[model samples]
Target chain A: MNIWLLIVGVGLVSLCLRASFLVLLRGRQLPERVTSSLGLVPAAVLAALIAPELLYSSVTGTLDVLNPRLVIGLLAAAVAWRTRNVLWTLMVGLGLLLVAQGLGWR
Target chain B: MRHPEDMTEIIPHSPQFRPAFWRGMRAFTPLVPGVVPFSMVAGIAAVQAGFTPAESIAFSLIGYAGSAQLIASQMVTSHAPTVLIVLSSLIVNLRFAMYSASLLPLFVGVPLPRRWLLAYGLTDQAYAVTMGRPVTEPSPAAYYAGAAALMWLTWQSGTAVGALVGAKIPSTWPLDFAVPLSFIALLVPVLQRRPQVFAAIVSAVVAVAAHGLPFRLNLILGAVCGVAVGQLMQRWQAKSV
Candidate 1:
């Protein structure tokens, strides 16, 4: 599988998914169950994506609670929760990570 | 709750498309700086995986997805099979379908071609920004196009810069962590109720516990289970209330 081909395939797959409802449904009413399920998509999917990044060690590929990522990510989560601001969450999160690394805490 | 400074009244009420576009762009400006670093990390990862600068930039253009691009780059470096890479990347992106479904009501009157284009440009940030606006908003397609235009430009430029100068970035900078941090910011506002919170918790736990599963099955499993839990919780809350 050539990388370029892979890219194209992935692009097409993504476009199809993104277009699935918008194109196919065409303003038609989705089933109520699906509409409700769609509402949870962001929370559920984002949490699934974020969890491994925060908990799993990047290098060792195992659950490590004390990893700098976990500590700093939790702090970042707090910032996000408190401020409800993307800029603040990112700045504080990355800032904490950089500082932890600077202090050789990893 | 229209803003006092809203100029909609002064203009002839023909659905102010241009203003909505600009409003979308302005609303998304704060997140632009944050997006650059996350995109840069994607570019750097691609280059580090032996993709040429041009190829890395191509990946950004063709894929146009942040997390999936990053995962694909890693899988490529590890010599993972192309099928697995594609499968995993698609799994990561399945949430976009949900976004498409949820946003369909807003685009009902939009033309077919424009809706297709809008769908192509759908990203988490742009979707979130557009959805954050008042549901009664006019010119939503214009607004989405505006935010997505800015987002696309920012991502392409940042990836270009990262790929061109990726080797110089110190490993200690922790640039990759910025991706998850940004996600946290996006996730927090969505967890406004118990059902959503419960969904997130269930999703995270399931994903983590299934970490050893191959081909990114865990993520799909986690998301499905989470949505199911959330649905049940919503019904239970309604019954109780």
Candidate 2:
């Protein structure tokens, strides 16, 4: 699969998904349940990606809290929960990690 | 409750291009403060992964998704086959399909050319903001256009800056964590109910459990499982009520 081919293929598939309802539901009302379920997609997918990276050092590998990346992520999550601000979360989490590294904590 | 006519009257008349464009720019302001650091990391990653400035900018503009671009760069560095690299990037971006589907209801009446532009401009940030709004009239396309254009410009500019200046930024600055933190920032605001919470928990568990699956299939599997769990829970709740 050429990279360009892949991009074009994925782009088409993505466009299809986006355009499906518009094509299918033209001149019709979407069922309420179906419409509501689409709402779950983002939160579900983001959690799937975020959880493992934040909680574990590696998939199918031993847990390692000592990993500086893991510590940094945990701190980021905490800041995110507290402040709910993107910049602040990044700054605080990354700041702590760098400081910890400076002190040779890892 | 007010009738549909009343609701229609409540919508302010759609603004012209100047106001719409400025509104789009204003929507992007919150994102500006965060992009410099994030794109700098992306830029350095692309450069270290052997991408030229043009290629890096192209990925930022065309690929559009930061994480996907980073992963693609990594795959490129590792000599992964073109198919595998593209498939992996596509898998990561599968979520966008869902975003587009959810937003389609709001923009059904917009013209095709406008829809094409909005599709090109769609980003996670833009979708987050757009989906959170109650559906308003006078063209949901305008609101989406405003938000998406702003995010697109900011993202491209940030990538350009990163490609130019990323090398000067020290690794000691803790930029690596910014990417995940950005997701966290996006995540917190969207966790609106029990079903969403359950979906997140299930997705996380499935992601961990299925992590060893080949081609990062775990992500796809986990997302499906999470969505299923959420839908099931919603159904059960409806029955109970």
Candidate 2 docking class: acceptable
lDDT of 2: 0.65
Where model 1 places Cα greater than 4 Å from the true spot, the runs are: A58-60, B1-20, B77-79, B132-138
- On lDDT, the leading prediction is 1
Q: What is the lDDT of residue A44 in candidate 2?
A: 78
- By summed lDDT, the worst window of 10 consecutive residues in model 1 chain A runs over A24-33
Give a tens-digit lDDT track for model 2, residues B1-241. Answer: 2223323211235444445445555666676666655666566667656677766776676667775666565556657666676665565666566676667666645555455667777777787766654444244556667777777777788788777665666755655455566666666767888888898889888987887676556666887888789999999999999
**What TM-score, computed on C-alpha atoms, does each candidate reach?**
0.81, 0.76
> Which tens-of-lDDT digit does each residue in B39-150 have in candidate 1?
7877888887778899889888888988788777766866777888888677678778888888876665565666677888899889889988777766776778778889
User: lDDT score, residue B98, model 2?
Assistant: 60
Q: What fraction of native interface contacts does model 2 preserve?
A: 0.52
Local distance difference test values of all predictions, in order: 0.80, 0.65
